[model samples]
Target: MEIRNAKETIRQGAPSDESSKPDHTTKMIVYMTIASTAAEGLTGICSVVSSFLNDFSME
Candidate 1:
């Protein structure tokens, strides 16, 4: 009975320690996604501005 309790306690403790660890891969993925989104937004804005200026200059 005591051995079972000890095993249960150890198992619970193990998960808490594992959960506390920062997953670098997940962080990297999130960072990459944010960077890609920002880059796409900037590119889209630049394209719009360039087209607007071209149209204005032609008018």
Candidate 2:
């Protein structure tokens, strides 16, 4: 039927339409910023724990 053919055409076109989406540069930048912030936070936690352990060991 014509309707079935049209439906198949529409279905095949859907993925190409979705693939033509724009880049998410802004979202990527935001994610990178968040990842950097998390890394800094983890570094601070490690430093603090090391310092505490050193002080306790000296006592």
Candidate 3:
């Protein structure tokens, strides 16, 4: 019957929705971590470059 099939489909899809939530959360966390690390590396490089330039200019 149509009603019985609808219930079966809903049951089948429940686990899939639950599984996707964790996957999205993990992906977001990984992206944020990578972004922060890249920012730190860039900041360090800029600081070094600025200091080097200042030293060179003084000479």
Predicted model with the maximum TM-score: 1
Write model 3 residue lDDT over 1-59, tens digit each, in one string: 99999899998885665676645777899999999999999999999999999999999
In model 1, what are the clashing residue pairs, if there are any?
Answer: none
Per-candidate clash tally:
0, 0, 0
Once superposed on the true structure, which residue ranges of model 1 sit more than 4 Å away at CA? 6-12, 15-21
Evaluation by TM-score, superior candidate among 1 and 2: 1
Kindly report which residue stretches of model 3 are placed more than 4 angstroms away from their true locations once superposed: 1-17, 20-22
**lDDT (tens digit, per residue) of candidate 1 on 26-57:** 88999999999999999999999999999999
Clashing pairs in 3: none
Q: What are the lDDT figures for the candidates, one per model?
A: 0.92, 0.93, 0.90
- What's model 3's lDDT at 48? 100
lDDT of 3 at 3: 100
Clashes of 2: 0
Better of 2 and 3 by lDDT: 2
Score candidate 2 by lDDT: 0.93
Q: Distance from true position, residue 7, model 3, in Å? A: 22
* TM-scores for every predicted model: 0.65, 0.56, 0.58
Tell me the lDDT of model 2 at 28. Answer: 100
